[model samples]
Target: MSDNRRIAEEIIKAVGGKENISSIAHCATRLRIMVEDKENINQPAIEEIDKVKGAFYNSGQYQVILGTGTVNRIYEEVEKLGIEGMSKSDQSKEAAKNGNLLQRSIRSLGDVFVPIIPVLVATGLFMGLRGLVMQEQILALFGLTLADISDNFILFTQILTDTAFIFLPALVAWSAFRVFGGTPIIGLVLGLMLVSPSLPNAWGAAVGDVEPINFFGFIPVVGYQGSVLPAFIAGIIGAKLERQIRKRVPEALDLIVTPFLTLLVMSFLSLFIIGPLFKSVEEYILQGTLFVLGLPLGLGGLLIGFFHQIIVITGVHQIFNLLEIQLLDKFGNNPFNAIITAAIAAQGGAALAVGVKTKSKKLKALALPSSLSAFLGITEPAIFGVNLRYGKPFLMGLIGGAVGGFTASLLGLKATGMAITVIPGTLLYLNGQILPYLLVNMIAIGVAFTLTWLFGYSDKEKKM
Candidate 1:
């Protein structure tokens, strides 16, 4: 048998064979497979396979890191093994059926947020850049003050930094429609209409800066800028309404009638009913989450820091996107980002310890890359493939994360925005708090690394 075939066979066997896998896909560096039974998979044997970087179960998927081109080659080989292939859409649909309530919720949230993270990440980088340029220290290096920057340049930065949050409702709407089996373009248009310039902006209405237009003296409708729940709820409603309308409308009038009713009914309902109701609901949730973050003496930070990755494992961490967005919109900065970064840095630290201490060359190669990926802001590889695989290391990383979170809270460090972390996260702290951010990261990494190396793995396991 060819070497590639052997590797493919090992992957197939490790993941509980052909009957157990529902779907498989590959990204840049990992093979993502949804297995029918996670418990049936043999993890250690998979890790022992030559050229297999690492293996871990996360977010209801069995992800195997094989590194770049090597992953593609093995994926092709797996395809030839006569296992039925499936698309990501299939996996998503299957997600609802395969797991418990928490898993399904996390998977659904992940489905909605993962598509949007790229745009958010890009915008967050710019927010960081804008802060960097506005910092007094950095301004000294440029021999300028905030006033020294031209009006046009400042306007451009404002537009760049603000555009994403302002239109976030549209993105969420578009994504939610895709997830729920609706026509995506219509959802995009629906999102656009939600934030139409003619309506009062959501934030302005909340703070009493803009009054909502009376809809026949009964309803107060506003644009949903910087909002998540309203758009998400609206999207679900719109998608289901569109699908149902399409089924009942005559074939000839289907396009016109279906869209017309979908928009007229759903958009009005969203504006008059769902949007306002959910907005009130989100306000309460926002208050609750902020209450947690505001607990005295860093207690909030310690709890969140220690448990964020545990939430990540369950795929429910994306739920925090709502609270993070709320904080950013209202307060102009996010301390929550600072706390979460600590958790991520600790995961990286723990992963690095495994890489350095492992006697297996394959694990050594895998650990370092995964650790670097975590440091650069993606923690799946580190959290699943390394830290969590070694149970002690995972807990150690959480301890380090808790310490780092406490440190951040005590120092009152906060990020200029949300969604960026670790090295990319550094950009968010450029407003004179960069030193504190770096220090928190060092403490997280150092503590996690020391504890994980000392306690996470034994010499025998390292040799294995």
Candidate 2:
């Protein structure tokens, strides 16, 4: 039999055979199986299977870590064994049913933010590259200066770096509307209205360059460029309103009245109530984040880095999506990215140590690749497959993360983007920030690796 087929069969047996499985699905790195009864599965036997990095119970599924490309192959083989599977959409619904209110909310937030991340990442890269070429030192090296660049060229660069954030509300609202079961096109139009060209820009109004429009000589109004809460709130309210309207309107009128009423009512609500109220809320949140990150002696960064990975294990770290966007919108730099990169790097380092120190060839194979994945900015494999499996290694990783975070804050390190970290994260720091960025990651990896090698790992664990 082929290796994938054998592995698939072994996984089936370990999970208590086809009879115990209700459904199966594969993500980028995991084979998620919904089992009829968790008690019937042999967890140890699954861990011992060759090429199986690790396995864990999460939300309501038994997720087996089988690496990137391997997961699809193994999943296909598993299906060929007579057990049917579900689509990723079905899998999400099943998983959603299992989490608590908070977990589900966070997961929903993640789902909304995920689709917009690539655009933001691209904008960040554009900003980084622009900053790099425009630097005094770099330009001087090329016998050029900032004034030497054409005005049109600079305008083009600004367009690339600024367009995503300028329309971020539209993207967020569209995604939120879709997630909340509303008409996404209506959401898009509502978001656009928030930042309509006729209104005074939020930033300009803030700096007194443009005066806000007074609706009734008191209620101030301005474009919501770079605002998040207002768009998100508007999206949710609009979606719920549309759903309610759909239920009431006759079938013939539903098509016309539903969207018209939803947009008309939501537009007024967004500009008059949700926009102003949530703008303050967003500011307060930003202030709170700044206060924490501004704590003395890098303590804030230390705490965040130390706890970030732990939070990931619980599956609620998507809350950072809001904070990072707020930071980038306000300060144009994200210190949070620098700190979390350290936490992620430490996980890889610990896994790498495990891979090197273990005498068991089985473990060595899993550990090395899992660590590589973590360094590339995905940590589930490293955290679940290697470091977390060995108690001491995870502790060592936390310490490494804490120290790295401290150093990052001390140096005031930041990134141009979110979503990517560690190896791919370098692109976000290329605007004269590469040296300190590399320092933070290297220290994190060094500390975690040294600690794990010297004290965290033991060949004796092979016997266990």
lDDT of 2: 0.90
lDDT of 1 by residue, 381-432 (tens): 7876667666888999999999998888888887877787999888788777
- Summarize candidate 2's per-residue lDDT along 1-464 as a digit string, tens digits: 99999999999999999999999998778999999899999999998887788899878889999888999999999999998999764666678888899998888787778788889989888878888888899999989988899999999998998898999899999988987889899999999999999999988998999999999888899999999999998998899999999999999998899989999999999999999999999999999999989999999989988999999999899889899999998888899999999999999999999998888877888899999999999898899888888888999999999999999999999888788899999998988999999999999999999999999999886433
Which 10-residue window in model 2 sums to the lowest lDDT?
87-96
- Highest lDDT among the candidates is held by which one? 2
Can you list the residue pairs that collide in candidate 2? none
lDDT of each: 0.84, 0.90
Off by over 4 Å in 1: 1-6, 16-22, 27-29, 35-42, 51-61, 66-85, 216-218, 360-362, 460-463
